[model samples]
Target: MPLIRYRTGDLGRLLTEPCGCGSQFCRLDRVKGRIAFRSALPSVYDLEELLYGMDTVLDFSARKEENKLCIQVLLAEGGTIGPVREAIEARFPDALVSVSSTLCLVSTGKQLIN
Candidate 1:
């Protein structure tokens, strides 16, 4: 199927100027950003940055269970989930964050917000 005048959900600017090497193809500029990934929550990339930036987190999953937000994590160096849960709760005050084993519930293979 062909899509015409469609929003690709990508964040960038189209460059129509000819290339210095005489190429006629146009290109897009660096990512300006996209529309809000999820209306009720932050974007996946943002969450990834937040989690991955921490030292103790080896891997994680941001998911929901029993009508609340839960984060499952694999810790490194025998780290504790208490700090992680507290950090997340601090960021999302109203969210009910819980700790779970690495067995996370994933739908559509991405963070299930909203």
Candidate 2:
């Protein structure tokens, strides 16, 4: 079948050149985030990438409430909140990071943001 252009809802860069591994297929660089979840600062997918860099954070969700940005996080067992909070604050100076055992999910099974 002939290849067709498709929208995957993910934001990323497409490399048209052949890869160093010798493959001729186009390569996708990094997937930044989904189109629907973009925000004024960064998308939840971007924030998730940042938080996941820390071993303590298992899951997280960010949303804007009123005039503040609130981030809810589910941490690993025995994880401390200090480092996670610091990491988020360092990147998003004004964000409110909250630690929780669980985070809410939307009907589609993705984290919910309001």
Candidate 3:
């Protein structure tokens, strides 16, 4: 199935001009940036679905020193880290999940503190 354009609760102004990509869909010139990606949490899904969602997941793939289940995220303002951690643990009870703030070098990397 073709991907349809839908609002993602991301509020931002739209560009009146058409995109260079040649799509007629109203393009958003500016939206959230990498900084917003620092506080994202994991979801309840199998690895297959998680991988599928990673296309829109920011900074999803990153290098890590420790071995653990990691999930990179870009969260909206006022979003708390606790709920995200809870969701992940509830979804995958067997897996140990941990949280960490964004690192300057890593930018928006996630490391599941095993």
lDDT against the true structure, each candidate: 0.56, 0.71, 0.38
Query: How high a TM-score does candidate 3 get?
Result: 0.29
Residues 1-114 of candidate 1 have per-residue lDDT tens digits of: 222222223245567889889989976554433223234445444555677888988766555454455556667877887887777777755555544456443453533333
Taking the tens digit of each residue's C-alpha lDDT, what string does model 3 give over 1-114?
A: 122222222234667688888988876543331121123333222332443343333322222224334554443455554665565456545334333344223222322211
- Tens digits of per-residue lDDT for model 2, 60-98: 876776656888999999999999888888877778889
lDDT at position 86, candidate 3? 61
- The C-alpha TM-scores of every prediction are 0.50, 0.67, 0.29
Leading candidate by TM-score: 2
Q: Give the TM-score of candidate 2.
A: 0.67
Clash pairs of candidate 3? 37-74
Model 2, CA-based lDDT:
0.71
Task: Write the number of the candidate with greater TM-score, choosing between 1 and 2.
Answer: 2
Tell how far residue 60 is off in model 3, in angstroms.
Answer: 5.1
